[model samples]
Target: MDIYSKAIKVFGKETQLIKAVEELSELQKEICKFLISRTGNVEEEIADVKIMIRQLEKVFDKEIIQKWEEEKIKRLSKVCEVVECAKKN
Candidate 1:
């Protein structure tokens, strides 16, 4: 079975949410380490987070997820644009 199926069999959806939160926390720690020490395993942490997200996708509605993703991209792009404009000022 695939990883998502395996995860479901072992942990179920409820526990998987907790797992996702833990994974995200780990990713945050890795980012903080990178910011402070510049030697963090960011790639590995991102992979872990991605795997958790994939597991989540199995339970969530993909259409809504896609819409949210697009919205986030737009919001982030606007943030970047504002930052760029500030840098030019």
Candidate 2:
């Protein structure tokens, strides 16, 4: 009855994966447009990407994905600190 269930019924794993990629691409495009023209539906594109990501969670292991995401964030945070330090120097 939920959106994910409906989406799964209509579009299977492979189709959903493709749609996810498309949605992410759209989000990226919107972000790039914002950087240049400073006019684009960035929020709407982000929402679409989030919806597609949740739809993806139905097929992928959410816990594992989240765990890896946290690890990546921690690693990126360290990299950000290094970059900041270099900038200050």
Candidate 3:
């Protein structure tokens, strides 16, 4: 599905557009994290990553959405970090 279709599927249209924006942003972030750890074929990997990010931008389309996404990603990391710390300690 295209970005817009995927967004509507995950979150109904009755939901505010901002909610769809947030979900798309989070998806892009997850893809980027996976792309970053690649071991080889940098050119192909970068090309795929750029396309994925551009698709997300088509949905989010604003500075506020970008900033909100970045902040929430940091918060989500804390959740994993805390779980990791508990395992170690």
TM-score of 3: 0.36
Tens digits of per-residue lDDT for model 2, 12-63 = 8889999999999999999999999999999999999999988888889999
Model 1 quality (TM-score): 0.80
Q: What overall lDDT goes with each candidate model?
A: 0.91, 0.92, 0.64
The deviation in Å at residue 38 for candidate 2 is: 1.0
What is the TM-score of each predicted model, taking all chains together?
0.80, 0.84, 0.36
- After superposition, the stretches of candidate 2 with alpha carbons farther than 4 Å from their true spots are none
Best by TM-score: 2
* Tens digits of per-residue lDDT for model 3, 1-89: 78655755676555535554555566566667668874345455455555545545655566877899899999999999999999999
| Backbone clash count, each prediction separately | 0, 0, 0
Better of 2 and 3 by lDDT: 2
- Please state the error at residue 50 of candidate 1 in Å: 0.2
Ranking by TM-score: 2, 1, 3
Better of 1 and 3 by lDDT: 1
Q: Poorest 10 consecutive residues of model 2 by lDDT?
A: 5-14
Q: List the residue pairs that clash in candidate 1.
A: none
